[model samples]
Target: MVTGQAVQLDSRSAWQRMRHWAFAHAVDDFYQGLVPASIPFFVLERDYSYVAASGLALAATLGSSLPQPILGVIADRWRMLWLAPAGLAVAGIGAGLAGLAPSYPLVWLLLLLSGIGIAAFHPAAGRDARRAAGDSATAMSLFAAGGSVGFFLAPAVATPALVSLGVGATALFIPPAVLMGFVLWRFQQRQSRNPVAAKHSGGRDRWVPFLVLTAVAVVRSVISGGIATFLALYWINHLGASQALGGAALTVFFVGGVAGTLTGGRLADRLGVLRTIQIGSVAAIPALVALRATPDPWLGLLAAAAVGVAMNIPFAVLVKLGQDYLPNRPGTAAGVTLGLAVSAGGAFVPILGILADHSGPQAVLTALCFVPLAAVALGLLLADPSAE
Candidate 1:
């Protein structure tokens, strides 16, 4: 007698969704953790110059990023449920192998391998979760925060491993990668009969908003890339801080991002994504500029935390905006927002590196401040949600 479909949210279903978010976060933590661990260490130990060393980061970014639009297109055409497990396995293996590579060329090849594998997971996982979340900003924020948590945890886990296990700790991360694949497969099978995914096969393009959003994303990433590569070095050189304190600042930066990711999403749910981005962009300017002026390590650290929060909160909300815009093509939007914008950070690391060498890190950072101002300018033109 019952012929139609049913859409209901139960406690069990909610728990499953949360688990998926954590799993996805773990995957990113593993992917991004490699940069702090392998990239710098590779350069220092090998005696490579900044420009040449940057090629490792560049390879990872170029490998991961340049493929997203194409990957999103493929996601639109085919649902590769199997890729979830396969991609994680490959990424894990590639990361582990990087430790063992006989030379720098092998490191690049391994990172590229890892990049391809990590690249496969984001778009698919994002699309699947958007269905479970039902286009809510809080849901997307929680999802994004999970990655921040993983990013924080990854270095904490790996750095100690470096002291005890030497480079082999890299390979040891493979078990978790394999576990991620299994979890995704289980979640997909359970949710297969759920009817809420109907929007996925329909239409999901908000051309104007997407273009505007991507613009801010690019500018934000340029600043973030500059920070990630040079923040620690600047602190050590100018602030008279030890290497440990500088590394701690990096932790503070990412921790603020974790806080921002969750808050940004929740605030967007209430205040709206456009509003959250405006506030975050306006708020970040002082934090970023202050780093150049402040000599006090404590003040700089506080500003760094503020910078992380102001800069990254938009990342979570922006992904949700992409989903809302392209309701049918959630995976594609997710890929472009999360994969491409985040990886764009890699492209600019070298540019800033060059500028820092010629003009000094302070000058490079000061010059980069205009990028956020641009984000603020372009963000004004973003269409209200009602348009979708």
Candidate 2:
């Protein structure tokens, strides 16, 4: 009975800690979302061309994506808990200041700084969140969903402010960063007083499987990026939907991602992570094919939602499994899976863009329909770390 009570208390404590981490993850990624959301306003207010606007985006992406693995290695070497809050503060400050900058170069620099901050936050947060999550895929899912929620909230939160106040409205988002940074810092202080020892799975690092998993993740990322980039266009052009309905379809797709993240975690806990990923990979093909086939705009919304859910079901699990696959280097695993793999997907988006140019937005969706097959193929090569 005493042991049972102790287990309950531990579980409750883990749940609470995961909640804080999830909230912090949301706050960190919110700034990332703010960049793309704010870009159109920059073009409008500053008379920037498409090329210039894309450069700003490239600056952010390069800054955020490139240093992550190195930072992950550093975090692993030093066990730096401070990076989480510090990075959060930096991300917020840089993004907030971008709107207030007078020149385009300054704006570009500020966003680059913001991206670096985001890069700094993920590996450390992933490492610590894994500690908090223990073996619960559901808890990890909550953390992953927080990021999705942050991203989903960005346009909603930023659009109103940008519309009313112009680009300078980005300054308004700065306070949340300061507030959340302090909250995360205080949480860290409390955690230090009662530190949870990192768990060692006593397993050897399996680079081949980890590489396979990374390939699967990159495939997932490509599909996700492709859909996000083209779904609204597909709805508006191919399906003959109103602009409003096109936006709604995108919203439904994102909301579905949040749901799928949570669902994947729960399913992982029951069905195992590897199996859940396989299911999601298989499921994405059919869902995307349905989206491609649907003629009715309203029905296509349903298909979009289904595609979102299916594509994202492996989202959190991939992160968790990456760590499991590299038990000796959790930070590196998270860095690559969370950072590099995601950014790598963007590199391929241009190919889809070319296809969209030649064929149509619908052709992009048609191409995405077959992309998940690569993930399925790679997934078959993965062995559950737990099984070993």
Candidate 2 root-mean-square deviation in Å: 4.5
Query: Using alpha carbons, what is the TM-score of model 2?
Result: 0.86
TM-score of each: 0.89, 0.86
Give the alpha-carbon lDDT of every model: 0.71, 0.80
Cα lDDT tens digits, model 1, 1-388, are: 1111112253344445556765666675566655655444555456756666567777777767887887776776676777656776777788878878888788888888877776777777666666666556776677777777766665556656654666556887877877877877776766665544333234435788888888788778777767766676666666787655666677777788888888798788889889998988887888888777788877888888888898887878888777667765667787888788777877987877677667655666687667688888978988876664
In candidate 2, stretches whose alpha carbon ends up further than 4 angstroms from where it belongs are 1-9, 39-57, 99-108, 163-168, 197-199, 233-247, 293-299, 354-361
| Poorest stretch of ten by lDDT in candidate 2 | 1-10
RMSD of each: 3.7, 4.5
The reply for model 1, stretches above 4 Å from the true place, is 1-16, 163-168, 193-204, 359-363
